[model samples]
Target: MGRQRTVNDHGFWHSPLLQQCTTEDKTALLYLLTSPVSNVIGAYPLVPRIAAAEVGWSKDQWLQVIERLRAEDLVWFDPERMFVWVRIWWFHNLASQTMGPKLRTRTLENIRRLPEPWLAPFLADYKARLNEEQRELLNTLLAGEFSENDASVPHGYRIDASSNFSLYNNNANAKPNSNVTPTLEAQAQVPVDKSGIPPESHAQVEAAIANAQRKGIVKADTQAIIAAVAKQYQAGRPPRDAGAYTYSIAQNLASVATEPSPPAPPSESELTAWADLCFCWPTDNPSSFIRVDKAGFCEQVTIENGNARHGYMPLGPSKLLVALREGRLRKISAADFEDLAKGSRP
Candidate 1:
């Protein structure tokens, strides 16, 4: 008599398959498969804090299991790099083998039914790379399952590769109505201006400063201190050297608020602005008044005889700029203009 294969009707992994793994390994694997686990295909690094919370284990226990898994080629940890990598291929293979072909087929069919447009490209690419057996399995699974609802072509079927398909369907039936406007009661409560500064204005300034810090225009410590002071002042507790503090914080906050938020890595808009600024202004002995180009590039020019001169200074490559535009640069490090300048090219 052969051992019967276990299958999970839920389509993910099942308890029966988990029985093959040690208790600790099972716990770790289950945590990795749970929601909030990003980067499913490759190595999944788990932070100690997150692992502790997820598995109700101490840091040492979690580390022990992580080490054991790594030794078994189930996981990998790079302490120096601060990442815990899981071998997804091995885990999936173990599950598939235990669960049998039917479970794998059903799981894949469900994945194909996911309506997100962003996932379409990945699915198409994966389908193209599939072996004949895999393709046949997928087709067979899909054949007897529920048929997909036929969606009508939108009025404007401009194939937007960048547009979010999931968002499209969500907003499809939405319509504007006169009664849809928010009532006065629904509006946010404006705090009274007790500090002689309008509460709204103070909030705006604080928000701007936060935004600047987020965009790498300011440091986290600087932002934290400024925010603390602003909050205090807004609540009627002015700091020492109130005027200077207000001015400094306001200036920093305003700088970011004035600029548009950059999108994605290597933002074309910011780069173009930098390029234009480089070509339009003088960079030699640059002054605070020197206007930056749309892409945030400074131009080169000499001010001879106390008059403004302008010429393009060839721009430099900057990883900071890329990080800033990509929204990955941390707020704490971003406030130091010198740090950002280090990555900027002439």
Candidate 2:
């Protein structure tokens, strides 16, 4: 029996490559994807007549669509064996990939239904086009016969049901908050270091520090180092010696923190004062950015000595500060500051 299929609405509609296809082409493609015969692998038994009937297209129209898809390398067709292989099929259907040895068993069942050689081209195409991880999964799915040396066949490698990380991080390949089950081959890729120790708990960290103090590590700064080391060990970078190694790590943090802090943002009142001193805001035109002296005065400055005058557009205190910082407004000249001081009387 063919495996179940799932089509994501967002992924199907907004796919970059599908955006290139016409509306009619998208509809036809969707039908091919969701049809009964199209299994989890996105390849299935399909002849021209069968496709034409299922898609409600004339044989000629169907051939034209197929030709377009083939040109884009979207779908590959095998005329001799009547097979259809959708390119990059694994990427789309990753949500259904929890199958393990059962997958290999299913392939053996399929071999009897569709002669084994019919699968050769699909498997070869998958290997050449896919990455190592994806290629490994494709091979696993097609491995129908039992192998004494199969890595998954080993009883020890079976997914540990009680492991929280494996359960919560099931879809390691997909985005966060997704339930997509990644292939077993993908899970095998995670770097495992048997020698790496688990992080210390908060109580354990405190206990280690108390122990360090008994060993004459009672300096206040030394205690700070122990705290930082405890944090690192707790965060999965466990050290071989949790009790004594924290001081060196803490000293490193002190050196790292010596970099200068970033400048603070100006207060809202400062922005308001700067605007009141600089611009005659909320202008008559409601559009002109009216430049003003410190005492609420406006200016008509000509551009390039032309009769055409430069006008100030209205900007709130926040936006006016942005203009000043961004250099859209120039700094006041010394002579202009003298004039502004004279006009300061209101």
Candidate 3:
């Protein structure tokens, strides 16, 4: 597919808001605006790891940039749902135009798919930007338009001076308004104590949750997975790497949810032979499979003269047995299996 194009307002550089952003923040914002995952409506799903990879930065670097942008009110990121809303996207792209029926339908679908907390805020912004024709179209398409008086607007919702919508009550001392609606950004900013998570570990858990979603764990299963992690923390038995532990649990849950019946236990005979395993190169872009022939190895491959050779440094037979049971190895018939033991380029 060809690269997608997004509008870049010539006035962007002159904006006062742009002056406040660091070079890194500006780069991150521009990337989000033009990212392939981004759509016409500007709100879209974006995995933190993927975004990091796109910019040739570490995950931490990407998270830091995103957090800064969020603080500056340039974007809203929902770590749990992996969604992003570029705050002023409409101004540069759709504000001056009247959308056709097809575009309007697609836009509505995109809006509906936004994370629950982002829906109202995005709609509010979208409604405010509509041209007369667009507004008329929206009136027909939506049962109730975005409005302060609209029932869909939460009870305490209000638009502040900056035009940001918040759901805090007037009673400042009344237990901090537990009834306030949770937006994705608000949820991300929830206090560590209330969330049962350590202040420093939010990013890790978010990354883990994104990983889980990629591994086929559905949104419905997230609450249960989070509960399991929270229970461990409460019991004072938290894992050394909370993110890794959460990912492992997610993997287990995903496996159970997908596989109706477990495979037969590995036999002793099956455990001894070399298992030929084929995996794709550059995982995300798989043009060819890089086959590993010596499938009995239990440790990292040894490199000699720029070639990979296995079995020189074995962890143990016990680990090998575990790998076999985990379905990580499968025996395959190849005429030159031994010749390819050292993972030669295909």
lDDT of each: 0.40, 0.46, 0.55
Q: Any runs in candidate 3 off by more than 4 Å, and if so which?
A: 96-98, 144-346
By TM-score, highest first, what's the ranking? 3, 2, 1
Between candidates 1 and 2, the one scoring higher on lDDT is 2
Candidate number with the higher TM-score (1 or 3): 3
Model 2, TM vs. native:
0.35
- Of the two candidates 1 and 3, the one with more favorable lDDT, higher being better, is 3
Lowest summed lDDT over 10 consecutive residues: which window, candidate 3? 156-165
**TM-score-best of 1 and 2:** 2
Q: Looking at model 1, how many pairs of residues clash?
A: 18
Per-residue lDDT for 76 in model 1?
A: 46
Task: Give the per-residue lDDT digits (tens) of candidate 2, residues 1-346.
Answer: 6645666665566443454577767766777777777765676777777778888877666656765555444566655566666653543564224234556455435433443433444334334334456557755655565332432332222111111111112223433323333322223354322222332222223323333333333344433454566566558777544433543343244423354443344455544565443432233322223344333233433323222345443233445545554556544444544443343312
Residues 4-109, candidate 3: write the lDDT tens digits: 5655455355443455578888889888878988887888999989999999988878877777665445677777677888764753575434356556667777
> What are the models' TM-scores?
0.23, 0.35, 0.43
Query: Residue 341, candidate 3: how far off, in angstroms?
Result: 99
> What lDDT score is found at residue 307 in candidate 1?
48
Per-residue CA lDDT of model 1 for 58-114, tens digit only, reads 876776665545433344455434454343332232322312454565455445444
Indicate whether candidate 2 or candidate 3 has the larger lDDT. Answer: 3
